[model samples]
Target chain A: MLDLLRLLSFGPDGWGDEIAQGALLTIELALATLPVGIAIGLMIALAKDSSSAILRGLGNLYTTIFRGLPELLTLFIVYYGGQMLLTELAEHFVEGAHVEVNQFVAGVVALGLVLGAFSSEVLLAAIRAVPKGQKEAAAALGLSGWRTFRLVTFPQLWRVALPGLSNNWMVLLKDTSLVSVIAISDLMRQTAIAVGVTKQPFFFYLVACLIYLVFSGASSVVFGKLEDRAARGFKRVGGH
Target chain B: MELLHAIGDGFLSVVGHLGLNTELMERYGPRFLDGVWVTLKLVGISVFLGALLALPLAVARVEGGKFLSRLAFGYSYFFRGTPLLAQTFLVYYGAGQFREQLTDIGLWWFFRDAFNCAVFTFTLNTAAYQSEILRGGIQSLPAGQVEAAFSLGLSRFLAYRKVVLPQAIAIGLRPLGNELILMIKSSAIASVITVYDLMGVTRLAFSRSYDMEVYLWAAVLYLLMVEVVRRVWDVLERRLNRHLLISR
Candidate 1:
């Protein structure tokens, strides 16, 4: 146990600082990906719910492809394929300039694409769950389409979308581990390094697991509070 | 005419580059097929084993006493809260740390093989998710249905066996299908531990060729597998819910 503590302790011999840094990277990666993902999800939800057939088909295809593929496979494709594409383009346009995709960018883009896919499905369902009459009522009040959506639909949509989106967020947090495979210095990658140095895979992995549990456990509480806040003006019929 | 020829040449060059990987495919084609087979076996066995384990645990969660319910809850909570990749690493590597003790108990052989470790980890992980889905399905049933079973002179166990389980299974079919799909996707993580599944083969092929086409081919295969699963599940869902379908 003393040996374990020393190995994890902060110093030249310890991986404590590296692991701490990795944890922060994981947080940063997830946060950076969230808004982009949510924005794409919102657009997709709108597209799927829109009256246009072409937009709906495109939205469905995007979700199906992303959600259906394994996240790791998606990451690999994004990282490697993006690099190849960029290199090709650079070679064609620039005489001798080289292009590269860093792991951070690759991780964010891949994860955000996937996040958008899953969250769009959730958001689409949430949008449908909002009563149709509410929109008509907004229009009856002489509210324009954009104003009605902003004032009425979007606010209610979040409440309806909260639980599913929260689940997606939890999943996104854990799925960030896949980025470690690409040599990203995320929590999982850092733990892998620690395991390599300390020859204590079990100890370091257990620590990683605990760190993840803390993140998820805290997120659950935070989401629960947000859910309660979203439901503040609503009444529960059976007190469920 | 010049612009048209340039456009044609550009398209042909792109195709030529992508198509030039025939040698890579020829060399790794059999290996890729073998990897797919291994992946299928891993998913099949783990999901089967997981469902078998989950049923009783789900029952315990929904109907058993405080101790059993809490035990079930704790298992699911821990497994669900952590990343599957971490759990895989813990099992694959962490188990190695206790080789002596495990060997003493004659369990080292299970942990020694990456395939076994993967199956074991995936089984436990899927079981946790499956148990929760089952518990939810059971809870979702109208209370009167179970009461109706009891009122028909069925004992509690018989009531569950005769009435509750069948109905819960029906309601649980879709979520259970979703679980299976998730398990299939997650089985790729086994590659990280050198299991040589599809992703593992892709990694090996890429190491040799450094061509991105290998990953593309692998992704296409994965997409194909997912599509089949989705289609099959849709058919199954319709068949299961046939009685519940409303007439237009």
Candidate 2:
């Protein structure tokens, strides 16, 4: 009993501090990747919806390649392959570019790339869900391309897209644990370390599970609030 | 030059290991084949065990004693909320601490290995999800039909089997199949615990070859597994729903 308390303490000797830091790293990792994912996803979505055949082909390839690959395999490709490619480019481009992919950058890029593939689906669906008449009306009003997208399309897209996007966020948050395998020392990695170092697997792991519950629960609550807000002023005209 | 050289050497080594650029093919066909066999066994057994355990557990949660319901709820929340990796560790390395008690109960031998532990965690994890799915399916059945079943002198068991189970299984088939595919992907997580399933074996092959060619071979194996299951499920779902398709 006392051992459990000691393990969770805040003192210098306690491992509680490390666990907290791990949680923070996981959060930071997700935050960093989330924006990258959203930007890449929107670009891919637009590319997929682009009138040009070349643009549509690029988007299809982007989603197909990443989506078809396993997340773990994708992680390995980014971590190992990214390093190999970056180092090679550095040697040629800048004598000694010293550009190495660290854990955070690797984790962000790996997770971000995969998330971009999935979120492209979400964004594309959102873009399509807008009543076609809205775009037609915008064009009829002489609003140009960017103006049509900016004024009429994008805002409606987010409101419609937020639910599915947030659902993807919850998944992305959970999957961040995969980054730990690549040596990112996030929550799961830290728990693995503490378990190995302490030799108290159940204690540390149960703590880890509790932490997940708190975080996942909090995320769902936030998602629920966002869904509610985004759903404002939109009532279903048909079946519930 | 090394980049070009690595690609050259990588391709040759990859192909030389097999005949006619059939790399995984001539590498002596059975290694991954056996790994896939074990993977399917792992998934099939765990899904079976999880479903069996979840049915009673779900019953306990929904209509059993109050304390039991809460206990089941706690178990569901904890297992479902956490990452699967943590659960795997708790079973593998964590079991070592309780060696004596497990041995005392003649269970240490079972807990001694990584495969057993991975299966155990997978079983428990899916059982929780299964229970929730079953519970939802049960609650969604029309109360009027149930009442009619009772009035016709059918016991609860008979009613569920004859009436509820059929409709539930119909509504549940697609979602359940999706879960099965997710489980197949999830079985890869067992690699972390050192079980050497398909992913672990692929990781080993990759480390030596350092060419992702071997890993690509592994992905094809996975895709085939997923596709086979998907096709079989399509047939089964169709057979079951022919009544709906035929229409009155």
Candidate 3:
């Protein structure tokens, strides 16, 4: 036990610092992807909800492709394919130019695209669940479409969407580990490095698992609190 | 034969128009086929074994005494709480740390193979998820159904086998299909451990040709597989629930 503690300690002989930094990066990657993902999700939801057939088809196509493909494949495409596309565009515009996609940014974009695809489904459902009469009432009160959505629909939409969004958040948090495959030095990769040096794969990998469990467990608690807060003004139905 | 040849050529032309580089397909086509076979075998075996393991555990969670229920809950909680990649790594690489003990116990051979490790890890992971789905299915049945079965003079085992399980499975069919889809997507991670699944072969092709199109092709193949499964699941669900369907 003492030996294990020393091995994971923060001093010179330990790999604690490296693992800690990796954990921080994992959280950072998930946090950075959250808003980008939600924004894309909102856009797709609106597009699907729109009257234009073309936009609706495009929205469905986007979600179907992204959600169907494996997250790792999406990451590879965004990392390698995005670089190729960007380089071609850059060279076309400038006489001589090169662009390299950052691993972190690639991670964010790929994960965001996937999360957006899924969350759009949730957001679309929530948007539809809002009473049509609410929008009509807002219009009767002289509210514009955007204003009605903002002042009347948005709050209720989030309350309904929160549970599904929270599930997506958990998935995103776990999916961030895939970025380690592209050498981002995320928590999984950091643990791999530690295992390599210490020749203690079991210990280090178990440590990584515990760290992930802690994050997920804490996330569940926090989301539970948020759900309660979201339900503050509502009456419980069916004794739930 | 001549008509078939013409159709093939037209297909090639369309693929070329889509910028898929038919020449690369010619070179790597057989290898990709092998990769698909391996991926299918890996996922098929794991999900099959996982469902087998999950049924009893799900029963334990839903109907077992307190100790068994808690034991099953802890297992599900740990597996579901962590990333599958971490679980795979822990099994694959961690086996090395136990080489001597495993060798002494005569189990080293099983742990030594990458494919075996991948299958083992995936089986455990999917079993956890499947148990939760099954547990939900079992619980969602009205309490009166089980009580009615008891009143009919059925034993506990008969009640479950003849009455409860069929309905629970029917209710859980959609989520079970979703879980299967999720498994297919996640089984790509087996490539990370050198299991040579579709993604693994794509990685190899990419390294050799430096072409990004192989990934696109792989993505298309994955999408097709997902679509086919979704459709099949839909048909199966309809067939199973035909009695519940309202006549027009």
Candidate 4:
């Protein structure tokens, strides 16, 4: 145990610093993913709810394809295929130019696409959960279409959406570990390296597991608070 | 004719410049199929075993005494809070550190193979999630149902077996399907420990040929599996809830 602590400590010989940095990288990756994913999710949700058949079809197809594929396979496709596509485009556009995608970017794009696919379903359900009468009333009051949605629909949609969105956030946090397979030095990968170096797979892996537990535990508390706040109005009125 | 020629050139360029190696695909295609089979086996066994394990666990969490409830909750919290990959590593590599003890207990045979270890880890992991889902389904039942069952002179076990389990199954159907799909996606991690599942084969093929199509093929296979599962679940849900639907 003493040796384990020394190994995980911050001195030159300790791997604690690397693991801590890896934890930070994991957070950065998830932070970059959250907005891009939510934006894509909103767009897909809107498209699915659109009047046009084509847009709905496109939205459905996007979610189906992304959600069906394994996250690791998606990561590989984005990392390797994205690299190839960029190289091909660069060659096509400029004689001597080349574009590159790093592991971090690949991880974010792949995982974000999956996140968007899953969350779009949640958002679509949330959007639909707003009572039809409410929208009709807004229209009856002569509010414009966008104004009706902005003033009447979006607020209610969020309360319905918060639980599912928080579930997605928890999943996305754990799924970030998949990027370690592509050699991004997230917490999982850092632990893998430590295991390889120290020949103590159990110890390092337990520590990594604990670190992940800390992250998920902390976020679950925050999400529970958010959910309570989201439900505040409904709770006061005896609504579920 | 012009379009045909351009297509041929594009194909040749993919073959030559991209180094797709048709010969290698022919060689490894069967191996990839074997990987798929192994993946399906892993998923099939784990989902079955996990469901069995989850029933008792869900019961413990929902109705067991405090100690049992906390034990179940702790199990789920520990498993759910961490990444499945870490759990996989802990089981796979961590088990090695205990080979002597396992051998003493005659369990080393189970841990000696990567496939068994992967299945064991996946079963434990999914049981946690499934237990939570089942617990939710059980809790969703109205308390009045239990009171009604008691008024009708049904014993607790009989009430649960006849009334609660069926309703809970119906309520949990969709989430359970979602869990199965998630497990299918997750079983790819088994490849990390050299189980050579579909993702493992894809990795191997990519390393050997440096071709991106291998990953695409694996993705397509996964998509097909997910689609079939979704369709089957839809049919099952309809059948289960047919009585609840109005004729209109």
- Residue-level lDDT of model 4, residues A100-121, one tens digit each, is 7899999999999999999999
- For model 2, residues A122-164, the per-residue Cα lDDT tens digits are 9999989999999999999999999999978877887889988
User: What is the Å distance of residue A226 in model 4 from its true position?
Assistant: 2.4
Residue pairs whose backbone atoms clash in candidate 4 = none
Candidate 4: list runs displaced more than 4 Å: A93-99, A131-152, A235-240, B1-25, B147-155, B246-248
TM-score value, chain A, candidate 2 = 0.89
Task: State the weakest 10-residue window (summed lDDT) of model 1 chain A.
Answer: A231-240
DockQ of 4: 0.71
* Predictions' DockQ, in order: 0.72, 0.51, 0.89, 0.71
lDDT of 4 at B116: 98
TM-score of candidate 4 against the unseen true structure: 0.89
For model 3 the TM-score comes to 0.95
Interface RMSD of each: 0.9, 1.9, 0.5, 0.8
**Which candidate tops lDDT?**
3
Q: Which candidate, 1 or 4, has the higher DockQ?
A: 1
- Comparison by lDDT, 1 against 2, better one: 1
Q: lDDT per residue, candidate 2, B1-248, as tens digits?
A: 88976775676577676653455444524466667877787789889999888887776776678899999888888887877777887788778989999999999999998889989999998888887777777778788878999999999888877887677667677667766776787788887777777887778766766665666677677777777787899899889988877994
Worst 10 residues of 2 chain A by lDDT: A231-240
Which tens-of-lDDT digit does each residue in A1-240 have in candidate 3?
Answer: 788878888868999999999999999999999999999999999999999999999999999999899999999999999998999999999977888999999999999999999999999999998999999999999999899989889888989999999999999999999999999999999999999889889999999999999999999999999999988777887756
Name the candidate, 1 or 3, with the larger lDDT value: 3
TM per candidate: 0.92, 0.86, 0.95, 0.89
Ranking by TM-score: 3, 1, 4, 2
Q: Which stretches of candidate 1 lie over 4 Å from their true place?
A: A144-146, B1-20, B246-248
